[model samples]
Target: MTRPEAPHALAITFFYYRDLPRAMQFYEDIIGLPLAIDQGWCKIYQICPGAHVGLVDETRGMNKWSAQKPVQLCIRVVDVNAWYAYAREHALDGLSELFENDQLGIRAFVFHDPEGYQIEIQSATRAGA
Candidate 1:
């Protein structure tokens, strides 16, 4: 069968949390993402032009909160150093030293959110990376 027609408009990745308000605050105040959509039980924040992340209340959401998070959220930015500095200043949980990956052509670091979700911030180090 042929692929479906029509281009996708936007993309969103949802993460469930026991405390929706706290998660919302972290994404809004700490991560500096603006709220795009606000459903009573879920809040969607815009990460960039077309990318978003949704914060959901575990009790009411499709998935329940779990301590073992097997997934990570990665975001590519123009200045990884600046972001790293911000992370350090905030004393973010599970903060890691910034490092370079030549194979990936990126300078990156990672930190955990309030509920232990790993978030990676990276910047391309070479052209077309």
Candidate 2:
């Protein structure tokens, strides 16, 4: 007898935001995602190992996310300090408070996008992480 296979997801969402260049910098420089696909104006970057972070030109979509909300992607990272420092250096707007979890002993901070959406940067615990 053979075991059934589990279905694979279609990767992460391809986020569309305003100003492709600004969005590109946020994802590539701040969030540290590598550029995987770039067709000028439109780009798709690797968020995690297999997850892709896409930024489309929402201005052309009429009611696109970038046109409506523009910023709503949150990434969980391993080093919140480093992440916050980078955000500070770049003058990104976001919260400076760090939240600690007693159960998991993990801590995280939040950063806001140009549209005011929050991106959480979390640090992993040794074993309980």
Candidate 3:
């Protein structure tokens, strides 16, 4: 007998937050991701085509907020320098100097979000990277 296959329609990464409004504001006004879904206590923002980040209120969410965030959200862009310039203009928290990694074939910079989640913006340095 052959097994049935299921195809995924969308991808969403959920982040639990103590302050959902603040997180939503940062993702909306700063990160500029459009809201794809609004579930009262949860706001889902589209990062790119088919990819989204969901912000959930810890009080109502399945997971509770933790002081330490070990996960990093990385976004690959067409122009990392341009994004870095914008990030600098905003004076984002824990913003690092843009650097290149030959091994990863990326020119990238990292910064912290409102709740201290590390976010990395990168651009490919070589072809097919």
TM-score of 2: 0.71
Residues 1-129 of candidate 3 have per-residue lDDT tens digits of 877687778999999998889999999999999999999999999999999999999999998889899999999999999999999999999999999999989999999989888999999999988
Model 1 per-residue lDDT tens digits across residues 12-129? 9999999899998999899999999999999999999889999999999999999999999999999999999999999999999999999999999999999999999999999988
- Judging by TM-score, tell me the better candidate of 2 and 3: 3
RMSD of each: 0.9, 4.0, 1.3
Worst 10 residues of 2 by lDDT: 61-70
Cα-based lDDT at residue 87, candidate 1: 96
* Candidates in descending lDDT order: 1, 3, 2
TM-score of each: 0.97, 0.71, 0.95
lDDT of 1 at 21: 91
User: Please, what are the lDDT tens digits per residue for candidate 2 over residues 5-85?
Assistant: 887754756666667788777777766778887777678787776677667787754347633444456566767777777
Off by over 4 Å in 2: 1-10, 39-41, 61-63, 66-72, 103-105, 126-128
State in Å the error of residue 52, model 2. 1.9
**In terms of TM-score, which candidate is strongest?**
1
Candidate 3 residues lying further than 4 Å off, grouped into runs, are 1-3
